[model samples]
Target: MRLMRKSRRARFWMSVVVAFVILSFLLSIVSYVWAAVDEVFVLSIDGAIDPAVASYIERGFKEAESVGARAVLLEINTPGGAVDSALRIRNRMDESPLQTIVLVKHSALSAGSLIALAGDVLVMRPGSTIGAAEPRWVIPGSEPRPVDAKTLSAWKAEMEGTASAHGRDARIAAGMVDVDMEIEGVKSRGELLTLTAEQARELGMCDAVQGTRQQALKFCGLGSCSQNEVNMGAAEHMARVMTNPLVAGLFLMVGIALLVIEFFTLGWGIPGTLGLICIGLFFGGHLVAGLAGWESVVLFLLGVVLLLLEILVVPGFGIPGIAGLVALGVSVFLAVGSVEQALITLAIAGVGAVLLVILALRFIEKRNYWPRFILMDRQSSQEGYTSRETGYDRYVGQQGEALTVLRPSGTALIDGERLDVVSEGDFVEPGQKVRIVKVEGLRIVVRPEK
Candidate 1:
């Protein structure tokens, strides 16, 4: 009985140990699953808010939404970008179903502030500033001019609508974009008040003035929210490369030069192919960046076609050429975001075209003159007749009258025999009297016979 009792006790202890081990294993799996399910996504916007940033944000939000992200944090630190691009990003944000939060870790000025206002919630760090959302025209060699009243009104409506949807004060947001605006008591006598974090809070411009992402997440009832960063992809990288000003300028130069060469040589071969490709790339990149619309592309293509016709079909540069040049200039100006950029691009393209033309002319002149100067013997044919015993020997010293204008080569009657002759030095009129000086290899050299 004693041995049986001891065996029972040992069996009971073994069962307890097995139960404890299974419970610990189950807890480990549960903890891992919970941690995996509670991750939050973070996307950074650290540069100017260009088309690339818009694309990145749109794609990131779509991806996060697909994965059922708890929240998406946009860490914004930008000055601004093209107005069109900012508007596009704002529209995307307003339509997105994901919980979007804009965390102004640093300054979000100009268009950047407009984008931030589009977010569902706005969070700002200590000492972080916002609200310089006015639109200004950037002109070369001059101070930026404020947008006109109509443009300002449109921008105000856009900002106000976006702010109102997010539970922020629309009037205050509108004031941020218009310099002449003054919120009733916010400004002193003749003093314009740019709202700080505290002022924004009092004016209902921002949701909260937080110090860190953790505090932001906690306030949103996501205390255990994890962070994930969305990085640039291959497409984004390619977009950036194509948008570079140096690259765009290089493409413009190569395209124009190739087209010019095609016009002059070989009647459209490899040069034409390369020219079309480069021009296509230039316009395609601008189109994707939202800087160029379909209208600009059509104008550009029409200009190219007109220019081609002027160079290849027309007798000389005239109305067609001038019109084509004007159209091309307008197209190029519309392709760039700002007038300053357009002018700079035009200057570079013009300089490049001049340089290329000079080089091509030199090349053609060298090809024409090099053989006559250095390789004269090799150029002469062995089977060609000479003046010593040629049938044209009787034509020497014969008086003739040029039938065609003789700049260098013309038609002249030599002893009643119509012959192809070259003027000696002076340009001879069509009816000018000429004397045959030499005849070699069917070439009749003539001189003006006083």
Candidate 2:
């Protein structure tokens, strides 16, 4: 009976150990699932939606997917940017496996409005505004104007489609792009549809109106999730600065102006170096933003080479010079990514460069530095600076023989000396006798001997 009791006790302990092991295994699985589903990736778009911004959002979505995040929280506070870039961001949002909870922190106008409606759940902060997405044709030097009819139609349709896809009112979206569109009491006949946070929520455009990011997260059911804020890196920031229209135009203008001044001045100097740096920044920034590529750089370099050939090697502005100008224009156009923008930039830069060159030349001339840059000393007759032989008049009646055939000009041996002579509208052949008729400056006129 003692042995049986001991054996029973041993079996009971073994059963307890097995139950504990099973419970521990189940707990680990539950903990892992909870951790996996509670992760949220947060991204922010606080500026214009350029290529860099689009790339940032794309990377954010990729990282969220990689970490098994349940959703992404995108904070938007922007006026607008390139429509193409906004479309790219929207496409990325649509393709992301993770749900996107967009939080409009301040303003979402123009292209920003398009990207805002791409999220699964959109929440707007209090006092924030959305809409005013009417597409504008904005050239750098000109005032903003309405886009063409085709562009307006297409953009309106795109906005409406995006809204309809998310079960929002499409008419409101259309009103954002088309000023003529009216939604009764929502917007006037000739005005765009810009809604406050409260109005957006009331109109069903916003899923919720949250005052803070935390509240927005709670509205999206990710309040308990661990948030990882993904910030823009140095490269992206630089890209944004370089791709800005004002900055880009300034860089181009300064670069061209400095380079033109350098060309007018003497050898290579600080102006040329600074000019190159400015131009380099312009292209490099566009490259980082994905608006320019290796092809554009290569083309620009080729253009520079051709231009140098025109200035240094070629005697006149012919094919190389014209081709160089065209190549340079094309390279800048490609870098700028828009025809009207590029044209305005080039025009402004060209005019600015001409004016700067004139001013620089005037300053250099006043400083008596003209002799260093150009041949300012002229060989004038009054100054006793003659390019002709002084005693050439002594041989005016001298006889000579033509050394080479000439239609109007040839070399002749006159008075046992070689002289470059010109016939008075007569053809003279080699080994023919001739007479010197006149001597004018460097000219020695000769006639065939009879």
Candidate 3:
């Protein structure tokens, strides 16, 4: 009977041990699942989708991965921008391990549509719209124009593929890019398809329609997740502003215009400094955006050096000047990256620079500011100021000492008047005694004296 009691006690202890082990395992599983679904990273992509936007998205993904986030929610609001930039953002989304939930808070037109469709789950806020994914040449101050038929066909395929990758309808995606494409009861020929949030849901393009961002997250099963909002840094903001074709063109225009004004009027001052700042902003922003590299900057600096050599050191504009101009053009062209974009920017800068220079010159002239910048005081005979030529004939036979080294031309102290003189066919060292041989108008010819 005692043996039987011992056996029961042992079995009771074993049962307790097994229950404890099972409880620990269940707790660990719960903790792991909770940790896995707790954190969500949010990124806001607003304004035009430029290189800066692409860079920000890429960095955001890296940060999310490092923090072990399970999903990323992108709040998108844009009128579209560079196709290359949009593609870069799309490719990044595809490569990331985390799930992408795109929330179109506002209009995601054109290239924005391409990116919106690349997400694993798409949600549109109430009243938000998407589509108009047509490829166009977006020139500032000009209407967007459609691309060539070949480009249209290629872009159409890309749009369709991106949408189809996530199980969205290829026809709807194609309809956004191809105006000729028709979706029965959705879009007619000759019209690009743009859909409201309700329309997007009904057409199966959007997974859910939510009134608020939190609701959208809840719809995606991330409602209880801790939010980490990633905002654009200063460098990215600067890049976005500087990379705009119109703004970049303006900076170039202002830089060149101000420098030209400063060159013609003052030696160097406010205008020149401001001009340098403008140019620096242009290069700095482009450098940050990855549009311009160190090579382009070095080329630009070399161009400036050559130009300065031509102006200050070289006697006239020749190879250095021409080469400098070419280098400047090439660097700008390379920085802009696109031929059409470069041409447009260059043309705008050229025309705007001319206008700015004209206006600045007029303002300077009207304000009588030339006296401050230039030697405006004139010495005339009426002021008892005699021309150097007036007494040059008197010094024809006078002996003088060379005041400056003469490579055919120099200054001489003839009778202590410091006359301008030219050597007779030979170089003359300073402090050498010389005699004036002839006077032709203002020209005083001199030779080394015995």
Candidate number of the best lDDT: 3
Q: How far off is residue 20 in model 3, in Å? A: 25
| Off by more than 4 A, model 2 | 1-37, 264-267, 369-450
In the order shown, the candidates' Cα RMSDs to the true structure are: 10.6, 10.0, 10.0
- Using TM-score as the measure, name the better of candidate 1 and candidate 3: 3
Reference-based TM-score of each model = 0.64, 0.74, 0.75
Ranking 1 against 3 by lDDT, winner: 3
Model 2 C-alpha lDDT per residue in residues 287-376, reported as the tens digit of each score = 877788878878988988999897776644678999999998999889978887688767777677778778877888789877876667
What are the per-residue Cα lDDT tens digits for candidate 1 across 300-343? 88888888887656634678899998998899888876666777
Clash pairs detected, candidate 2: none
lDDT per model vs. reference: 0.77, 0.87, 0.89
- Model 1 error, position 288 (Å): 4.9
lDDT measured at residue 306 in model 2 versus the true structure, 0 to 100:
95
Clashing pairs in 1: none
Query: Residue 6 in model 3: shift from native, Å?
Result: 43
Most accurate candidate by TM-score? 3
Instruction: Tell me the lDDT of candidate 3.
Output: 0.89
Which candidate order results from sorting by lDDT in descending order?
A: 3, 2, 1
